[model samples]
Target: MTETTPAQLIARSNRLGADPKNTNYAGGNTSAKGTEIDPVTGTPVELLWVKGSGGDLGTLQESGLAVLRLDRMRALVDVYPGLEREDEMVAAFDYCLHGKGGAAPSIDTAMHGLVDAAHVDHLHPDSGIAIATAVDGEALTSRIFGDKVVWVPWRRPGFQLGLDIAQIKAANPQAVGCILGGHGITAWGETSEESEANSLWIIDTAQAYIDEHGVDEPFGAVRPGYEPLPVDARLERAAALAPTIRGIASTDSPMVGHFTDSEEVLEFLASEKAPALAALGTSCPDHFLRTKVKPLILDLPATASVEEQIARLHELHAEYRADYQAYYEAHATAESPAIRGADPLIVLIPGVGMFSYGANKQTARVAGEFYVNAINVMRGAEALSSYQPISDAEKFRIEYWALEEAKLQRMPKPKSHQGRIAFVTGAASGIGKAIATRLAAEGACVIVADLDLEKAAAAAAELGGPDVAVGVAANVADAAAVQQALNDAVLSFGGVDLVVNNAGLSLSKPLLETTEQDWDLQHDVMAKGSFLVSKAAAKVLIEQRLGGDIVYISSKNSVFAGPNNIAYSATKADQAHQVRLLAVELGEHGIRVNGINPDGVVRGSGIFASGWGANRAATYGVKEEDLGQFYANRTILKREVVPENVADAVYVLTGPELSRTTGLHIPVDSGVAAAFLR
Candidate 1:
């Protein structure tokens, strides 16, 4: 099987499911039914606005979309399962279409129903197809993925496919992600953006594999997951897991595989399952857990028994689990240390080789990478001999040991930013980027700190000046690096200005199963990181005798009445108050502090789309067209601000614009005062 993309996603209301006469699935837009106020933003989820029916996502637009409510679609599916009253479903859809005239629901909505992620994207990239269909795909996948990724035997895709992924994650908590044999890959995250990156990586990996083989064939195949099945029954069942992730590929092509290669260093690259992942990654990092940090190739003899293989693998896992227990027992001294619920450190499933654990998804990914590197040596040991990443026992114990969990707890506290030159983490993109860019454009020399130094440099470069921007890579949460970034900024830019504490991340997860470490990440960046960057900035600002501004990028979430927003909102509230206190204390020397509240800024480098988790995106109506006006409509000014807009606002505070005002906040949203303000 090869990778694929849907030529068109026709709304059932549109009556344009197929065009036998024309290959393109073309249809008209039909209005959706039902509209309601989004609790978070109060913006109406316009139930009607189907853009178009049939068009490849690569070429999709608002015109290609058909709008329909998740509720209404559920109604239709309710009537149509058992292939019962499909016509009735169609008739009902038609009535809604004629009444609304915007867009119809996609036929594949049921598939999306199965996912727990937010945004879903399915495409048949050429490279992905090649690897999926290759005869020795298992070997090739092993060669490419190593221990970084998990390989699932080829299975027909659909509701079962989504179930497989969900099950895999649960069964193998140590696995980074799973690979679909003979089918394109899938990735998920706490946010829509991270999922998108994971999706892209699937294709990236395929392309890398093809390139390695140096072959190009007419890559085409039947679309795997899109057959019209009895979807209505499934929809009802899937909806139980509120906010389904959905994606449809109209055609199957080889260019759809994920990942390029493990070009990233293990320790440096974060884990796939790590928290705030939606903020950290562009796409899936080189998949390591199931795939190995890299791949392994073995021309096995027919004499090898399945039992023999199972033993070799389970034995390794036993070693891992045992070591993990030992480590936890040793480190469990903290009257039950905070990270008691942490995940396993390492896992080795026989033929699956081995994988390492990480503090966060990012760090776990780093662990996978170590094993991937080790795999290369395994192959070189001899034909029958293979290398494992530090035996199962060693990895398990290391990964699970309480000392490991303690390390995360004992991470260097954030720098006390009292004017010592505040550094904003995540400045490569989003709110942080906006603040940094704003500072540089406004004449204050700004250093863009990001984990990806290249992205940092590019962001600065976009300012179109050398002196205005200095790209410095550092994890703001890391004390030493935070200090180092500050030192570099001081040496190069002279001194720090009002540190615009404007970098933040959010993960929309139901608290029930959300990992323990993820919650820490939210505080680490929003609360802890804020304290560190501001503390450093305070030192420099206080010494200068010049009052400074520290603007934080908080969210409407802080004031929300909801369930999943706990980690983010709580941290935002804490951060906002912290700024207030910092202002009161630092005001003695002219140092000022403030925070900026903005709704989602979807435009201008939408990394969220890059890492989109198909499930959540659809729930919040994070469609492209809706994004432009989504926040705009919610704000008071009826203007949707972007990263640049927020950046400019922060720059103003640091520049001549707001020299007098401190201990205040500017709402970047046009009219969204009620959410965070009132």
Candidate 2:
């Protein structure tokens, strides 16, 4: 057990899991055995340290590795030979832990214990998966690394897989590794360094073998450098389908989809063989567990209208769900529980790249990444011969395995907004962006709605990845546009939990100087825009039957007016009243309506981008640089108001602090006397 301490083992696991090409998030596992004194008996006993269920190897910690008595775990093999149920085996493993319910030892711990080495590494590296899932996996394993590794046929991971692994090790005493067909590879050594190096060496050697002896005839039809049709090029078309797909996939727990149309993704989708290959199955079992066996494919034309696309998507989804039910029926056993859900985790559109779904943006992005990698693995395997993934029965067995189900149950509880979705208008900058950022940080998927699509997308990208936020163009003043945007929010993130109606503009002029154009513009955005966006989002919340929060970014001018600001003040006043009416109407539906009136945020606000601050500073007879100080001095608290100050007020109203209170306006103007709530 030299150099195989828990700390060293964790470090080795992290090194191997760090590279996605090596192993994806929480995809691989490693284990080591060392001797420790039993506290009660005062005797040395072999202790097996394995990665805990649902722990990511890349960020492995001492706590993530569960310590089990090797002798007790190994004894289970003798006690439960030819076990009748997965539950019995899982329970046996749990009993082997030093602490009764400390952390569930990895399902692979049984097999790891039987390995003749002190350390064992099980990885789902793409390079080895390509060979392991190939049609002639046994032949490929024998040909590539002759006598260095043994090849085990496809076996659902459980007590049976562990037994098979032990028998293989007993027979091939000199073999350093075993490649599980249609799964991944495993390596063993007396030292952690050797196990890590041997595992990677096996993968690199297989990849080199593939490179050296090119396939005589590739199986799939893939072309190099096809015409680039980015998803962004058809942003409107893609956005149209987001809400539809999201709604169909939504179960009791909401899920969000991450959209991607990078060049590589586009090239893969554009390939003639993509549809056929994608339908085949996942390249590895780990992936089958994350994403279902295959994605739901749809035919979407770039020019299709939102209505047409929605109708078509609904038709396709019906068929997809039916097929999924058929798949479950075909493979279910008496021991198997009811199928979790028939919803597809991945969706493929002909003209679009790809979209992956999960409970939140982070999980969605992981699905997207796994699917993209699966594409590459499928191509690599096809080139070698045929892309031969595990059979449907095997996939079903692993997907519904009791041990796997327990892993999910044992995971920690989620954050308050873990599966919630939010839409923030004018989120490209200022207070809107801050609110979106805060929601995402709290584990909510966000939609960045703005008039500028490109800028909105850029802001979404900055906030997180495509998974964390989606950007859509919407003129909130236009009822149709507002409705479509709300529909898209539902489609992309399942449903809306919080809506920040923060998109508005200002016009500073005397009542006489404020002409028809200025007056109309202010009222259209501040008054009409708030009404349209709130009503549309309210429809979603009502349909979901889940309570939601709606906050309007009203202005301090609603309570206190400034000279030459009649148009802006009047519109804000309208917004404040609209909140009250909506609150009264939507209260029975469990939707809380609130407002935050902010002032003196001259720096980052979009309303002041057109030299408004300079003009205001001139009126005060001070330099533009001194405007912040002037505003600060005017406030009773003498504090400068920032966009974040406004954003904090929004959180207070939506957060548990005021969960029971609604129809209220919180002022964020650094204690402006006239604007204080009276």
Candidate 3:
């Protein structure tokens, strides 16, 4: 048989990890044993390559594997201080490093190393977990796979658990794997192909059994009046309540949110047993780690007014916080890590759907997905028998595990705009796009709102796909369009925390040459449009009760008395004052309003490229090509300003550095004396 290599192991891991039915995001571990010449001794030595801590299987890379000397790894069993000191074994793995180990070893490293197989897979597939969590799991395992698979009783994953599995494998010579009681499954094979095939067989067989013998309605009958709201109404309600839920979830720390009203979620929410099941919480450690101990479920029916639902949400959130604090107190010991946060990570609304929160968008979205997996597990478990998760004490042990705490502590500090959602008008190109890109780089989820839907979508994709950005079309001058844009933002990222008013068209003309159409067009999009967008965003921001930012990308023309720029100048001036007015009016609600005045952003400016560049050049007696330089020469700083320059000013004004400064304008025209705020 050809020996499995690291590359092949990665391929196998990706195949299994990519499928949700096999395992969840960042939830499983895979390993391969091989022999390589030792760098120091120039002799062949066996090594175990296992997925590292916090690495996801689907995207696993060679660098994400922890390589340990097989001899040293197995030798630790002799010195193992028993289950009481199992955690210390994780640190001891460092001593077993084959070389400069690729990545930090995960706690499950022992499980893979101690198992006497060329390949091993420990997975948390929903189907496998369903049977593992069933009250009659041991009996069911015997009935389903017979002698081919065995069952291991509940035990915290550590060195002892590894020894037990190794012993089980040795004793049951014909057994290919075992169902981990109250956990998941572990499978092994002499080769990588066999390992992957065995894992799949177990998962597929378990699912087949559940499907054939399971009850018709695992979640119970749909409750009256608790049916899903109409599609539009459901979204509208989710948008209305998302901000408040996000705010409540952010009590301990700022968080980004994700909303899901998928068919499965709706069905579960409408089920008679949903309340009881949700309260019992998720069974898998991976599920609860991301979702929290359990979700905070809104008891109100779909018929309840959004206002009533929101009120109930607050009460439920308070109760969840209190209950979480009690859970921590009940199980915490002197050595346990301090309670991380009392705020619930997942919130379930009977009619609307689910809202999951995390420090960022991907995490938030994945948490929601994991909860769905939990839902699946419950459905299958209930159908097979009774769903029984590990005890609270066991869950508490894992949640506050020292190793897990270290992992959290190792996370990088958040970027300045982390957990913020920004809606940027005209974001398909030029200055707006630059601002959106900059904000996204600083960890903000961006809503790229533009008049052109295709261009907006392309730009959003370029920024980082749906997780970091989404595109929405809006004619900001229209109140309905503006409101819809804000609604899209709320649905996309829970709420809008920052608003950038930058969509405008320029038609440079003398006061006599400027027609009524030009004046109205410029004013409607820039002046009134800013007002419409701000008004709509304010509702969400106020509902969230989270202080936010509103920035106007007013031009230097707002202040500079440039010639033949009457209509454009008027709208800029309007936008400038609107910033000040809204700053004062919205300050009570903690919304900061600011403005940026930029000149000669001609190179990449959509306004300039669209005829304004040539028109401005003719007015100044310079070639259109030299227009940017001409504007720069006239400025105090002689350096031509670009869209990125304006973007930098936007970041500074709205970032933590200017947290205390508002109702201000920061000039970004390379020190334009005329544009300076006096």
Candidate 4:
């Protein structure tokens, strides 16, 4: 066989990882053993290049591979101190690294290094795990593959497990792989292509076996009352319950949530066997690490009203937390890491579907995907025999493993507004766009709400696509539109914690020239609009019980008594007062209401470009293009106030720096002395 290179290994890994049916996101490891010239010794040396910790194989790169000298790696066996000291071996891997060591070695490094194969693949394919976790897995393996695949008993992943697998491989030369008891599967070959083919063969063969002999209903009959709700009703209920679920899940720390109602999830949730099997928990270490020991299955039936379900959710959440605390106390030893969190990462509702929470959107989404994989494992295992998994004590050991805690510790500090969701009206352009960009950069997911759907979507794309930002058309003057925008926010990002009321237009006209139509138009867009948006958002904030921020973009004219601006000025003044009123009223709920007062923001502003600048310039007797400089000259600081200046104030008001400062109006008018707050 031709020797495999690192590049070929990467290609092979990508192919295997691309299909969800083969393995889950970041759930497996692949390795290639090759020879390299030693820089100092000027001689050939063997090296093991394996996928590193926290990397997804589908997107693996050269930088993601940890290169270790095989000679040094194998030397650890001489000093092996038995099962009790297996964890210390992970730390010792640093000494075996080749050169700068591309990426951090993972717990599975020993498995790759100890096994005598030129190429190796360890994966958690749903089909492979089914046979591995079945009650009669050993007999099933013997009957299905004969001597082609071996079976190894359950063992926690460490150096000792590596030794066991190595011994099994040596004893059975005909075997291409082994079904890791209560875990996953491991396959290897003399070349990358062979190894990949072997892995696929094992997965396919096991799946075929299950297909031929499996029972008709693996998860048992669907409970009559637990059948999936109608499509519209399911979504409506999911939206209503998301904020409350996200709230309880984030009791310890803020989290972004993802909801799914796929066929697999709905089928399992509606099954009579779901509750008992869910309590048994996931078998794969990768599965439980992201999903927690088990999900919080909503006890109420699908036929229950949404209101009743919500009420029962609160009680279930309390009980879940208590049960989690007990689980921690039952298994914690003096050497174990502190309890990470009591909140269940995955929450399952019989008909409403599942909601998963994490520190960010991708993590939350991937956790849900992993739980689906778990559901598949459960389905297949039950079909083959009974779905047996690792014991609670073993699960506790891996969950609180010191090595896992160290990985958590090494993670970089989170950005300022991490896990926050912001809804910005008029975000398609000008100050609103600037605010959205800034907030997203600080780790807040943004909902760009504007009257122009195309522009809002374009700006959302520029900010970072659906993950970080999404666009919704909203005429804030219309209360229904405002409500719909908030609903979109809830659906897109679970809920809104920050709202920027910045949608408005101005008409530079005197008292006689300012018709009644002008007054109504300006007031409706700014004064009434801010109130409508705030009112709609408050319901979600109160429901979440997570506390929130509402910031109004007023103007210097709000207090400075600018000339020929009666309607615009009146609306601005009304908006400024709304900040104070809402701040006082929402204070008990920990919702801070604030405002930013800025002078002419002429550059790149949609309002200014839409003829408002020319009108203001004509009113002030200055060239239209010079209106920005004209306004700047009048400020005490002589600085041109741009949209970014207003955006900066919004960030500060909603950020932790001003967490306690509510009902505050920050003047971003380049130091307009007359507009200064008293």
Candidate 5:
């Protein structure tokens, strides 16, 4: 065994994945260290680190590792001899994974300790996964590797896997390391040189076997699932998992194009009548944190609801967790707690795969690099044989490890929205301002549109710098002006997925005293403006083939019909009526329509100030300050209807949290029951 040179390491690392560009989740993790850098807060995290669970080990680093006290680990193992209860096992692993005890070893620590050698490395390399999990994996693998590496039956990782390897070691005290059946390979050496060489040789041989069989490339990888998070912070989260550098994320990060399966795979799937399932981040032992327990397979067509999708993902995770819990309950001591919260089941979205966080630049680069290559390998070998994963029972034991759960808890950023956009009409102040600010905070590029150009400009300035929020000047009621804003949105940010239509004016007058001019003034801005904005969104959303979300700022008076405000009430209904029809027409195009029926907004700082509210209260025998609050607190929930309430509703509509319901109007009237309590 010889020593590996740095140049040799770098060259090998570059070849570890596709999109060797220093980006997270582009294709997969890079094996290179220290390439990711934080774009915001301008702080640098680790550059090189060990890859997460089942990550492309080809792109690994020392910092990414969950360094643990090996002595402490052995102590925990002794206490729980059976370690069978899934929850108990998970609790143990989570506690240990945090390795907060100065030596937080990886969840795979035990296996690394057992099967690993002077230089030990394991990976669920794409090529190996395909042949190993196939119908004829045993025969195919046997035919390819011949006598180079020994093969054993599939077994769960940890003590049992360690035992299996130990047995193999026992039989041939001097024999080379063995590969786990239906899983991945572990290359060990007397020295790092021998280990890396063995690993490369196995990878090459596996690639040759796959190429000979003419398997197609990995197809239909869709990362559609998104969790809302801060844009700059998301970039920072990406940076932390790296070895040395940081990452500069953009609005474009969420705009990755979708990829469907090839004709061959599509045909195969249709004929079999089975929904397509993806093997997440290498499967089994790597299943817990990085890619979760399962990948988000779209079941051939797209899953309908975001909530439903989230439900399905959680259900799958719950099933895996339950099965784990049952196993431990049945087999081990009853005192252990479940490790890692339910949140740790981080499933990779079908279209949007897993991302990276490393200690140094090299580590992050390598993690992304490795995933890109591994995914390709998984796809390429599909035609040759199916990549069936290890049984769930075995997967639970490894996943529930206390050490692994601990590592997950410390993840810098666990949620993000990658491919969505938002717009806020009258985004200069109050409700509109709040809505735009919230969406931008959660990683959506907000187009702050207002007729008052100066106000919009000032609002954008407050958001600081370019990208998070951009001010657009246009009158929502004017067809041409509305269109120019739409065009600007398309050109500047690809397309819009979210719009909070908050541009409107309010007035107070008795119904008998109302005239044509006051009525038109209200209708032109609120009702017509809402329709024009929706109209523009429909065309762009349909063209882009991406779904859209629209949030109308309808007033609570639309339903409640408060005293002395007939025109405001009428226009609010008109604006909301447009949303229902809009839903019918745009549903097929993937656009959702929703509205917020906000009540008595006292901070009415948009186009029209709350001067109307103050005057109305004086005329109605109440204090100006008490009118808004008085009306709001009369509700069942007894909460004040503030700008924040309206803003929250808009935020929910424009994000993945409410991606399922369209054409639905939510009342931000502090939970007032629609009917009176007689």
Candidate 6:
């Protein structure tokens, strides 16, 4: 095997997956031919180890390698004549598997098995595809690489294509690799190192040719000062556009919108030729599975007001959907699957850059990343020559392939809160962060809104990446700030499914000692803050026509007034009454407003850290260390109430289990008799 081991094969495959220029996420495959001891025969049998179906080359593992009997696989070529159907050919390949531990063999296993080399690699490199998918691709390939490379015209990846590749390789013994017109390139050698070297050489060679001969265009129009616009300004605009896009992009499944403004995205958007360039299809045909044939483009003026922009976006979105439906109807066949949803996955805005739409944040961000790389490659191709991608017919075949459709339909059921977005005020730390993490664990994308922007970012990072949890800074008490925070959530995550009004501060002063500022602070956050968030979120939920939740985190003091805590107790009482009123007003719209009363959640809570625990202990003539036990003893259940206890209650209220229950108070205080709902 020329010193090529399984570990080396895996390393090389991972290297290919890790580089976006070489492979787009899970788009490529690699294989190695070796021998393994057969369990039945106890003899060394020839085998082919190919990357498993749906596996990413960047994070490949040995276990991810599908082992197939080489002799049996080779024999399929002879029997393949009668198997005209793709499924029949696929079945024969599956029958050739040697074991059941690994994943299914890659879809390109037939092509890999036909190559008479120890190591084989098929990669969708950006530079190579730019030339391969061009109008004069075959001629350009001959002129650029000459004898070193062979050319294969476009064909669906199946038995026929594999047979063609095998025949071409046999005919061109001097060739090191072959470029599949409008697809990608394949490289093979006696060793993994040699195969990888050949692939790199081909990519580098193509890139160098473009660097030398491609027409370089001045990328984007620059302002007088050349300094980019403030990030906050872009974010503001992106937020304003989020709800409109979300409303327009709704389909069979809810889609989360992720906004991105990377340097590449900005530069591409700023170019004078952006609209024409964007009209060209994806650089690689496989990207159709992620981004579709092309993105929906919009021209967003810098001077447009939020309302005006949203109105324009809504109108454009309707037109985009109509166009998508027309495209579907034009090419659909009897055997083709039902028309897929009309929502465009990628939306490009001139000033706002790009927004990738998906069922959740992870998928959205992945689409964004793919488009960024696509933009870079297409820019180079545009400067060099016309960026000619595959036709709509080819895209339709790949996008709705029966095998892919079946696989996608059989995908595991999503979690309870999949595609759901949640907003949690004061989520930077303590009870808010705990609740946010809990929501994410159940598959909800959470917006961590906090007064301290830095802390909010840190908390979001701690929970997960920006895709799972995003941070927005705002004073919940400020009306304008609350509205902005609501906008932030919608923009970052498309829409809000659950809103947690958990932002509160403790003021533990006697009635005579309490100042006007302290009273206003407590009321502003607990009562006014909850009102503003609920009002804005309710509007969004109504527009979405999807049922949603509004959860108010009230204190036990709302029921039984505590000594020297008039501001905290009175504000919490107001919050409880507001929840009932909101529940009455919003119930008609299918938006549930509920309240959770948690008592003495002293452990790891923001109020505890802000001296509430010490103040309570001092008032009760006990040390702070004994505060938790003191509260525990006071409750009938005699269990100390923690943040998670409150979070669990929130989950129940927000989830479908309690869907029929609204306008009610749920106690999460280990059975506090005085705080019990009467």
Model 4 clashes, total count:
0
The better-scoring model by lDDT among 1 and 6 is 6
In order, candidate lDDTs are 0.46, 0.80, 0.92, 0.92, 0.55, 0.82
Q: Best to worst by TM-score, what's the order?
A: 3, 4, 6, 2, 5, 1
Q: What's the CA error at residue 74 for candidate 3, in Å?
A: 0.4
Highest TM-score model number: 3
RMSD of 4: 1.5
Stretch of 10 with least lDDT, candidate 5: 242-251
User: How far is 426's C-alpha from truth in model 3 (Å)?
Assistant: 0.8
Which regions of candidate 1 fall more than 4 Å away from where they truly are?
Answer: 1-424, 464-466, 605-607, 610-616, 621-625, 676-678
Worst 10 residues of 6 by lDDT: 220-229
Please write out the lDDT profile of model 1 over residues 517-614, one tens digit for every residue.
86898788779888888887676555443455677777666565445556777888888788779889988877778777766677754334453222
lDDT of 6 at 111: 89
Candidates 3 and 6 compared: the better one by lDDT is: 3
Which regions of candidate 6 are displaced past 4 Å? 2-4, 81-83, 218-232, 299-305, 451-455, 472-474, 478-495, 531-547, 584-590, 618-626, 629-638, 659-662
lDDT of 3 by residue, 1-678 (tens): 234489889999999999999999999899999988887999889999999999999999999999999999999999999888899999999999988999999999999999999899999999999999999999999999999999999998888889999999999999999999888999999889999999999999999999999999999999998999999999988888888999899888888999999888999999999999999988788889999889999999999998998899899988999999999999999999988999989999887899999888999999999999999999999998988898889999999999889899999998999999999999999999999999999999999999999999999999999999999998999999998888899888888999999998999999998899999999999999999999999998988888999999998889999899999999999999998999999999999999998888997889888999999899889999999999889878799998999888888888998899889988888887766788
lDDT of 6: 0.82
Clashing pairs in 4: none
Q: lDDT of candidate 2 vs native?
A: 0.80
Q: What tens-digit string does per-residue lDDT give for candidate 6 at 14-79?
A: 887887888887878999888777889898888888998888899999888888889999999777
Candidate 5 lDDT at 29 equals: 23
**TM-score versus the correct structure, for each prediction:** 0.37, 0.76, 0.98, 0.98, 0.47, 0.91
- Which pairs of residues clash in candidate 6, taking residues 3 or more apart in a chain or in different chains? none
Q: Candidates 3 and 4: which is better by lDDT?
A: 3
